[model samples]
Target: MASHPNSSTVQIVCHVPDTLLDGLQVDMVLHSHAFVIRKTGSFRNHTVRRVMTRAPIIITTIRGGLANQMFQYAVARRLAYLSGGHVVLRLADDFEAQHERVFGLRHFNITGHVMYESKLAVTLQQLFPAHPQPIPEKIIVEREYQEFVPYSGKPALAGLKTLLFVPELLAWRDSIQLAGYWQTERYFADVPNLIRHDFTLKDPLDARNQAMLARIRSRPSAFIHVRRGDYTSPYFARMFGSFPPAYYHHAAQILRTRFGADLPFYVFSDDPAWVKQNQIGGPDAVFIDWNDDAPQCDLTLMAACRYAVMSNSSFSWWGAWLGERPGGMVIAPRIWFKSIPEFQDVVPDRWLKI
Candidate 1:
């Protein structure tokens, strides 16, 4: 079972990179008493009323893509809940110590602290601190280029997290390589965060989600994810792939025949345009537009759905895993992305492979 912080006094440090701190600011503030500090001295004289040493506090960081950032957030949230201290993203000069060594870049003061996790409460309990030991530098900084992907917006995801444990990360890396295909390592190098905890997708549009759930609760509903991309850059273009339009169409057909047209299908995807061009003509299908506002929340909300139809992307993997409901059905491509098992593990055992 998960736990939560029970402290009142808190000290949060924004330790996000120079680039990603801004995007996640709102997410951090919502969870705890969070603040951005440029140096260690920033917290010099702050008064902490609570002092519970048994509770754990989190100072987390990571370097990976957006999917990786989501993983990091998931891990940090679980760690904080399990340990009792709120999660804090340290955003000070000293906080930049490890990042500068790993990335070999000198930029500091990244983006947002709220998006990934909340800062732990500032209390005397933290003075003794109870958290996982730090992962070594070798594991954290080895083979930097092996993890790069071609997505232009990768920095958005990479910048969204901080490094906490390096050994666990190295183990995850070694496992992916052992699975075969060196290229697979890059894509999955940062996936440990997903395994840390199960995410529960919430409704994106607060009012609409409440309204939709209220109505859908009275009847049957299905969530569909129509994926249409195999991200293969020029270097790895040989792996270029796209799912057959028939894949989604066939799944939709199965659901319609079994569940009836009266069931509502909430279509969640990264690309709405592609879905429109290829979606099965079903009156029950309702395409949910993310509106490009909160990408992280939109994805999480989709994952919250009990029923899902996933594509072959880590983005969808996290969502499907989180959204899985008891006795729910998840339909995914049997042969996903160049016939690679590395990319296919996103399909959990609960999902039906087509």
Candidate 2:
């Protein structure tokens, strides 16, 4: 017989001879000749059962923009898949005043559960004891990309529960509270099809976007994404600096060689004026600037293109991944960050890096 420390139940395992086990009653008696009885003590109030209940939920905090949010959700989804538990997204609204970021996962067709900060606090208090102020009987995993150096091949954390993920770490079968960027496909490569299904847009494309999609599919097309909003800032640039113009020049040359110089090219950027000022696009290139209010529509259009020349941003990374065509070409920058080494797992093996 075995018992769980935190549970109010007891399990009994026994083997009996077939002849001596005749007329055995599982509910009332053990056998016709012998009877089983329980002794009353500390476990008197406990109920004996054959199996245990379902595993606890794994709660992961969701932060950042659309692409970063996808990474966080993918990690939590993979962990839940391995542990046979559900995942609850803890929406990080603290940055709303500064970044003006809103929860964008609802726009997708994902079926996971989500909880706001107010409801998460209440649920945590009700489930666990009050001794632990924030979360009780839970593991807190934080992102430590800056301090923890990669390429060392060291374990990110020692314990199985509370962990700090630097780059990527395999999750064991345990309910944990995860908070990280998890900016790599290797973390959840086991469920790529499921993740793609979850990332599908819930709403249909509008008229303008549908027209753009048709244009993209009509002939040979290429997408060039220029990410330059926060990346231009001095502080942010030191970490995630903008890719040089030479990288784009090289990528465009490769696409032109593959699909001919007359191929139509679409330029997507946060600052279209910068693209115009630099004359980055070719003669046939069309600048996409009307979908500022609907960024997801822009992503959809990028995905419909035949080829992609991506910047060092998750937003473009997702676009290239989603819009990939059969025998299509995707060219990315060799260096993702100025300080950190190249994230080998972020870009797929098949994609070309210049």
Q: Name the candidate that leads on lDDT.
A: 2
Residue range with the least summed lDDT across 10 consecutive positions in model 1: 173-182
Estimated TM-score per prediction? 0.53, 0.73
Q: Where in model 2 is the C-alpha error above 4 Å?
A: 1-53, 93-95, 124-171
- Please give, for residues 153-183, the per-residue lDDT of candidate 1 as tens digits: 3332222122212334332311010101111
RMSD of each: 10.9, 14.3
Give RMSD (Å) of candidate 2 vs. truth.
14.3
| Predicted candidate 2 versus true structure: per-residue lDDT over 28-78, tens digit per residue | 133423335332111111121232324545677777788888888888787
User: Among these predicted structures, which one has the highest TM-score?
Assistant: 2
**Residue-level error in angstroms, candidate 2, position 280:** 2.3
